[model samples]
Target: MIFDSLDVSYGDMWGSHQGMTHPAPLSRAVAARRHAAGMEYAVLLSSRERPLALVESWPRGKWRVYLFDDRSWRMQMIDFKPHRTGMLLAHRNTRWQFSTERERSSFKWDVQETTTVLADGLVEMRTEFAGPRGASTQPLHARTSDRSSVGPEPVPVRLFPAPVEDFLCPAPEFGDWQVFAPFLAQQGHEPATTVVLNDVSVDEGSGPLRATEIEQLFSSGACDTPDGPAVVEPVDAGLLRITSGRLAVSDPGWIGEPRTVAVPPGEFLVTLSLLRTTYGVDVAAAKVTFSDIPPREWEMALRPDEDLGLLGEGEFYGVGVDTGTVAFMDATRAVIEDELDEDLFIPLDGRFTVELPGAESEPNLIAFRAGRGDGSYPVWIGRTDDGQVGCVVVDFQLHSSGAEE
Candidate 1:
């Protein structure tokens, strides 16, 4: 059985399945097999790249396929059959998911359909196939048609204990949340609104959106810098200690797989622009300043190969926030090569968090609650007019109630 399971029956005690396996998206073996399948399809396309990678047919309602990008074809998304979803693999990350068209429904009918590819790779859902039903761990349950069979039932042999309720990691306790947790949580997804922060490069936000207005945020009682007025609040709780020159802005949960930017190795200050809005307080922005020099320009910061141009006017490339938290950390901390890789449970809303007792040194990371809850947020880079980077900002776009002019 080449990449297939053999249905071998050794009587009642043990049995196997035919041609089946589960998805080990991160497994090297599974990836190799997936690539092999893609390659077989690649050969059929006569070496030309195509959106449709591979296809396999089985009894009715079972048409399996794989989709990927090639030199000739790329797909932003595929309107595929979801009813019979077997397994899905997105871009590089094994543990990935998808969000789809809200107005439309189903596969949109058609055994064969054409869809566009993102080509950028990061946001792509590249492969999916027929799910395999592997051999069961125990014998299949059966009921005897003959009522007489129950009188002499085989001594009920215990199979396995009940499943353990799996909640591997409970939310870290409130006491465990550092002092900053409460401060960070203070600014919330209030007014239940979103603000689109424009790239510093495209500064059309005349009143509040402009980066120029950024330095002037603390207008009256601001620190005077060579560039302009600044309300630079130093993070007394902790700092982002940079051992490696690269700076990374990401969800703290993925620090092990650091995607970074080169910078001078040193300790940097992370500042948050907090504002009291109509509904509640909001974290307008989180910035990591590299140096004292003022930024004269801003650009959408992203991993290399990600095209900012592809994003619409208000659209931006963003990192995932799975635990209602995001972080700024040293680039070196991320050691995952290609292996592709927390809300402290309860909301102690008014309680203290963020500062760990006895934890006084500079931290490798600073994670705070993301706007509202788990979702995606974008990071932007601020640069001096001469091209020196002054700061990095993760704008939650929550400050929709524009500041007074």
Candidate 2:
């Protein structure tokens, strides 16, 4: 028998097969051996420096292979047959090649079946053989019949369990309206009718389509809208003031003459051509809403004044991981001078959920916890590589076990 049932029986569990003699820590040792068997060499062609590394076994087999990029986590496997001399490569839907002692030239071939076994497996599969060219025409005969009485039973397909159901993180809901950052529109594959953000370096969309005009308007904050009195007032050199609603500065660096824009009641759109500080020239747009106030009741709802300091650091900084809103502490002496008696909500680790506006997007909320109430907020906002913005809250209490202090 080529394989001893008591030694290398792979498929299912039987009586004595489970009784393989293993030393102390047997389970871990066995797991480590299996893990080692699952490792394979991969050469990442893109990177110049450290281009080679040991990756999980390629879907193909327990051997070495080359990949153009080390990007995707999942991969497809390639099938092969070991020849009597070395190895015969079989590739029809694969982008790889192989070599052996019998062939020195590189060539491509359609899928084919060859009556060959590994150079090592050949020792048992060959009949008559020469000195160096070990096996030739004849194949070794097996005494056991293909339908032997003691042969393993044909395993039913139902032996394997069906794949686990895919997990979908709970989507976020909005009471009325919300704002969203840029995210890639995965179109139909992910969520189409819901909020979707763009996060791709390439300006072109992922699927076969062009970005919507709304996205273009948001990217370059400049659009044509009917004139109205400006409700925002410039408070200082670096800050501006909005009375009650949020301030949407299309151009961060665009500082024009101080002017007022009277916003109408109910749903309204305010467009501007703002400038960014860093890049030479870039513009984006923002949409604001005042649902409670009716269009005709604009004068009664006008609260056109602001504490300019709110427009600075806290406006763009200290974004909560879950809430998708920028929060900051009133650390300034001015607010404390008046004895505001408000809780100084400093950034501590916290998480909140967010439903990006416009396109269908996943709900990203925020959560954070404190470690001994360290006064500092644990949650902070950061930009992803694809321009998608997100937040993360940290809890110091949970980290006590690993704390160096």
Candidate 3:
């Protein structure tokens, strides 16, 4: 009897019976052995490579067979009728008869069958059965004989626990308004809404105004406005000057020509109003709120202005930052090898989750940038599922930098 049980038993367990069909001759032989009376026997068959079959004959002429076909893609069982001759020819003849006819003839059938008897007296059979256009070929074959030989014991299978739930890493936190404010201002620029400052200049000794100096100037209450107290803060490569009320200026040094600038209260208010409308958040509050979230090392695909010195190496240098692609030389190859697509590349857009060996949770955000222009380099940032957070930078030049010439 063929039984499907959910629980694992002492005997072998075949998971699913779907797409399973009987192997004609072998199936018949097994059925005949089931009815045979008072027969207790054991048979083992082997060839040059390994054991081919292990058969046990029981009382009432019944038999139990464990056959392994090394050539088949998946595991399948064939039931067969016991032949009186007790020879391998009994199994071969079953194949010929089944290959010639079909239980359902409306479907066209094409078969390819072959039988070979090795010099060691082991018989090998191979048969392919094909049906309609979408029908796949079913290959089946087996060998039987009276002589028995001992084969190696079967290896036990190990099962692993299923994953509990899917995890998602938090998105990388971009710098507060220091980075986003400029991006927003650049995007907000338009011919119809352009604001021009007549003249502006600051004497900060030569070179350029350092961020520390700008911050000091703002905190010192050097610049005051009619609306209220005003402050000038440093952000990125620019300065943001805002009044207690509505007057404000972004990217003060962006234009380069303005040594000194005079601003009309009405016009200043209008510009500040526009900026407020565009950002939809109080500039100071937004900056404060974002600052509290903790800054992560994340930059856009086209931007990589951060610096790395002796402590660590730079990002990969192949692909450009604008390509939205990053490649790791040999650093992350093992980590992402199995998850790579046809091109051997994985997308950095967080569309797919990767299994990092020790990761416990997915990163919040992941970003990549090419350290160079060749498209072979990669730099990435993410919080690993294991709750680790950091950046991975790989560059061929860095690798060779320390090499003795």
Better of 2 and 3 by TM-score: 2
For candidate 2, the lDDT comes to: 0.21
Ranking by lDDT: 1, 3, 2
Better of 1 and 3 by lDDT: 1
Candidate 3 steric clashes: 48
TM-score of each: 0.41, 0.16, 0.14
Instruction: Write the residue-wise lDDT of candidate 2 on 1-405 in tens digits.
Output: 011111111111112112221111112222233334432212111112211111122322322222222322111122232222332232211232223312212222111112222223221111221122232222112222333445333321112222111111111111101111001111111212443221111121121111123222223333332222112111111112223222221111111211123322222322222223322221122223223221221110112442212111111111112222222111110122122112222332221111112112211111112222222212211223433222111212121122111
**Model 1 over residues 1-405: C-alpha lDDT tens digits?**
011111111100011111112111112222223233321101011111121222222222222223323221212221222122332221121111223322112222111222222333223222231111232122123222443333332322322222222101122111111211111111221111222211112222221123335554322343433323334332332567777677877765555544466777777776666544444444446777887888877766667765433322243457677756666776645423242222332422542124211134433665555655676666667787778778887766553322222
Cα displacement (angstroms), candidate 2, residue 267, comes to: 1.8
Candidate 1 minimal-lDDT segment of 10 residues: 9-18
363 in model 3: Cα distance from truth in Å? 68
- Alpha-carbon deviation at 225 in model 1, angstroms: 27
Lowest summed lDDT across 10 adjacent residues in model 2 is found at: 175-184
Against the reference, the lDDT scores of all candidates come to 0.38, 0.21, 0.24
lDDT of 3 by residue, 122-179 (tens): 5556665554545444432211332243542222222333221111111111111011
